[model samples]
Target chain A: MTTQPVTLRRRRLHEIVSPLTIPLVTLLLFVLILLLAPASLPKLVTGIILPGLTLAALYFLIAAGLSLIFGLMDVLNFAHGSLFMVGAYIAWSCNVGLDPLYPNHWPVTIANSNARFVIGLLVGTLLGAGLGAVVEVLLIRPLYKRPIYQVLLTLGLVFVFDALVRSVPAWGSDSKAPIKPSLLAGSLEILGRRFPTYSLFLIVLGLTLAVAVALLLRRSRIGMTIRAGVQDSTMVEALGINVRRVFTGVFALGAGLAALGGAAAASFIGVYPEMGLEYQLFAFIVVVIGGLGSYSGAAIGALLIGLARTFSDHLVLELGLPTAIASASTVLVMAVVLLLKPGGVFGAKE
Target chain B: MPINGRRTFQIAQSGIGYVPEHRAIFRDLTVLENLTLAERKRGDLRRSGDLIFGLFPRLHERLQQQGGTLSGGEQQMLAIARALVPDNRLLLIDEPSEGLAPVIIEQMMAAIQQLSAYTTVLLVEQNFRMASAISQRYYIVDDGRTVHTGAMAALRDNKPLVQTYLGAA
Candidate 1:
C-alpha cells in the first residue's frame, strides 16, 4: 500500500474518508427510507429495527467466533456451523426435558421461566464448547497446513452433524420453536414505540457481549496475549506461553460463543438441521464485509446487513417490485461495498 | 548450517529466551502488547515493563505503535526484551546486529552486556568485532557441527584460521 507515491492531499483525503464512510452510508439509507415513506417512517423504523437488530445480533455471534478462529489459528473450520446447530438442538432438548417442571408448550407460572432459560443456555453452551474442543484437538488441528485436507474433513463433519440432528425423532429435519420464557414473549413500550421484548433482550445481550469482548481484548492480560499469538505464536511460545493450550482454549471459547448465540436464537430461528448453514452463510457475509480480524467492523457489518435486508424488503414491497428481489438485497449490499472498497470496510492488506 | 533452522525450535521451547535470527515479532500487536504477551506468559508484566523500558526506552515511547511499523533497531529491542520476560537462566540471541545501523548495533551490544550481567548469554553472532569485544569464549560451527572451541583471545590470535573459517572476522 505504501509503495504508491502518496501526495499530502491523498493522505488528508484518506484521513477524511476512513471514518466517514460507514456513517454516511448509514445516513443515506435512513434518508432513503424517510423519502420513500415519510408517513410510516416511525412505525416502519420501529418494526424494522426489531428484526434488524435481532438478525444483526445473531449474526454477530457467529461472525465474531468465525473471525476469532480464522484470525488466531489460521484454521478454516468449515464445520463451525455444526456448533451453532448443536447449540439450538441442545436448547430444544433442555426445554423439553424440563417439561415436568414448567409443562410443555406452556409458559411457566410457578417455577421461574427465567431460571429455565438460564439453565438451557448454560447446558447448551457447555455441551457445544466440549464438542468444539474435541473436534479441534482430533480433526482440525492436524490439518492446519493442508487446506484441502481441512475442507474435506470439516465438510464431512458438517454432514455428520446435520444427519445426527435429522436422526432425532423430535428434531427430524423439521423446524420447531424452542420454549421462550413468558417474561420475554411480548412487546414492551419503550420511549414512544412498543418493541418486541425478545428483540430488546437480544439487542442488550448482543451489545453487552460485543462490548465485553472488545474490552477483554483491549484491557485484559489474557486477551492481549491471544491477540499477540494471532500475529506470532512462535514469539509467544518463546516467551514461555503454552501456545497449544491457548489455541485450544480460544477454539473452545469461539465455539462456546456460537453455541450461546444458537441457544439464545432458538426461540427465534427454531431448531433444525439446515439452520446452521443458513446462519453460517450470513456470518460469512458479515465477516467479509466487516474485515476478518476486526471486531467492531463485524458489529457494524452485521447491523448494515440486517437493516439493509429489512429496509430493502419493505421498500421493494411498497414499490410493487418483485418480492423475489428482496432475497438478494443483503448480498447486493455486500457486493456494492466490495466494489467500492475491495479490502472490505475494515480489512487492511490481507 | 544455521542453528536458526528447525532443530533450534526444539531448543527454543525449553525455557530459553530465544531471539530468532528473524526476530519473531508479533507484527499485528502494539509494542506494549508485544511486551505484555511475553510478561503475561511468565511473571509480573508491570515489573518487567519497568525493567525493559529502562534498557530500551524507545519501546516505551512507541507503546501504541504496531510492531511491524517500528524501525529495525526497535524491533530488535522488543525481541530482546521479550526474551528477558521469563526467569531465564541463559539467553540465546541470534544475530542481534543484523539489519541494524552501526550505532544501533553498538547500543545493542551494550544492552547484551547488561543482560549478561544478570544471566548467562549464549549469543549466536556472526560479527566478529562485536563478538570478540564482549565474549569470554567462542565456538565455530561448520555444516551444523562444531569445528573449533577456544577462548576469544585464542581466536583473535589465530587470524589465518579465523579468516579461513569465518572470512576475515
Candidate 2:
C-alpha cells in the first residue's frame, strides 16, 4: 500500500515535464539572446512582442471557438476562418452604411462603434452559427461514428466557403469591397510610439472574451455539459439532454466567436479573399501550441506567440537578415515550441 | 402510424428519462445547472424536488461543484439526479453500478428503490444481483437486442436462467 503511493508519485512526475522547465528555458534563452546581442535585442522584443500579441490575440479569438467545437462535438471546422472573414466583411459594410446616421460620426463614437461592432458581431455570429449548423446537419451528422469522414467533409467545406467568399466583389470599388470603420482609423501613443487604437481595442476585446469564456465554461450549466460532452458525449446524450442540440449550440458559438474576431480584425485590416486562410494558419498554430480544447492554454499561447513575433522581427531587422528570413521568425519560434512540448503548454500527454 | 392516439412514430415519446452508460458530466457546468437544465417548469415542483433530492443527498450538498471534478459515485448520483429533474414517468438508467465500489452500489440500490416508488424504472444493468434486488421485472440484453424478460425473482430463483442468461449462479 505504501509502495502504491510512491509509484503514483513517480508516474505523475514522469507523465509531464515539470511546468517550470519550459518557462525557465524560455527565460534563459531570452536573457542569453539579450546579453549576446544587445543591439538587436530591443528590436526583436518590440517587433515580435507588439504585433505578435495583436496577431496572437486575433488568432486566440478565432481558435477559441474552434477549440470548443473540436472539444465538444469532435468536429473539425475548416470553414472557421471563412466565417471570420465573413464577419470582417459584414462589419465593414455596416460601418460604411451606418456611419452617416450618427452625428459627428467621422470621429466614431463609443455609441457608433458599439452599434457597428454589435451589428457585425451579431450578424457574423448568427451567420457563422447558421452555417455551422447546416454543415453539421447536412454533412457531419451522418458521419458521426466515422471520424475520418467528418474531417474530409469539413475539409471540402473549407473550399466551398472560400469559393463563396471569392464570388463576392473586393471591398471599395466592387460589391466585395472590404469596409473599415472611420473611428478605428486613428492611432494612439504607446511607449512614445504611435500604435493603431483599433488594434489595441481588438487585443483588449480578445482578452475580455477569453476571460468571459473561461468563466462561462467553469460556472454555467451549459458550460459543464460542454465539458462533460468533450470527455464523453454519449454519456451526456443518454442523460436525456438533446446531445444533438448541444452539438448545434456549440458549433454556433464557436462560429460566432470566430466571426467576432474576423469582424474586429477587419476594422483595422481590410478584408481580402485569402484573409481567412492566413488567419486559419495562425489560429491553428495557436490552438496547437496552447493545447487543443484548453481555453487558458490558448490565451497563454497567443500572448507568447505575439511577444515572440515582436522580438523576432526586431532581431532580424537589426541583424540585417534577409527579408524572407526575418519574416520566418514566428514560424521558427512555433517549431521550437512544438519540438519542446508536443501536447502544447496545457494539453494532456497522449 | 399512431400510438395511443398520438403518432405511432412517437411510440417512445411518453414521459421518458435516459441515463447514459458512460461518464459524461458536463465538465464545465455546476451540479445545480445540470439538474436545472433538465427540469421542466410545467411539472409539479414539489414532487420533482422530493423525488430528486430524496434519492441523492450528495447532489444537494454539492450543488455548486463542477460536474467534471466529482468522484465516480458522485457523478453517477448527479447523472441520476439530472434525469429525475424532468419528472419523467418512465426513467431509463444505463449501467448505474458500473465502476462503483460495493458500498456505493448499495447506496445506488437504495436510490433506485426510492425512485421506483414514484416512477417506473427501466434499468439496464449487467449486475444480476443488484438488478434482482432492486427491480420487480427484468430484461436481459445481448448484442443490442433483448433476449429474455421475466419477473426479477424468477430469474434469481432459477439457477439455469441465472447462469445461462446473466453468467451468474
Best by TM-score: 1
Write model 1 residue lDDT over B48-158, tens digit each, in one string: 666688889898899888777789999999999888776667888999999999999999999898878888899998898898899888999999999999898989989
Per-residue lDDT of model 2, residues B1-169, tens digit only = 2346753213233566777786455544567766766655535334577767877777888887766678999999987877777657887788999999999999998998988888899988888778888899877878898898888888788888778877876
The TM-scores, one per candidate, come to 0.88, 0.79
Task: Please state the error at residue A324 of candidate 2 in Å.
Answer: 4.0
Candidate 1, clashing residue pairs?
none
lDDT of 2 by residue, A1-350 (tens): 00000000112344445533554565565566556546443344334455666887788888888777776666667778888877777776566555666443445434465567667667766776677677777777778778888878777777877777767553432334434445666777655566766677777888888878877776676776676666666555555456778888888778888888887777667677678878887777777777676666667667766665555555566677777765575576667777887766666554
Give per-residue CA lDDT, model 1, range A1-350, as digits (tens).
01110001112356457735764676597568658855364567576766788889988988877877776776667777789889988887777666656344445323666666778889888998899899889888778668789789988999999999999776787788767878898888765788778888888888889888877776787777667766666566667676777788878987988898899989766788888898888888887777665566677788888777777777777787898777787787778777666656666643
TM-score for chain A as predicted in candidate 1 = 0.88
| Model 2 bad stretches (over 4 Å) | A1-33, A36-48, A94-139, A143-146, A170-182, A219-221, A323-327, B1-13, B27-29, B40-51, B66-69, B140-148, B166-168
Local distance difference test values of all predictions, in order = 0.76, 0.69
Query: Model 1: how far is A346 from its true place, Å?
Result: 2.8
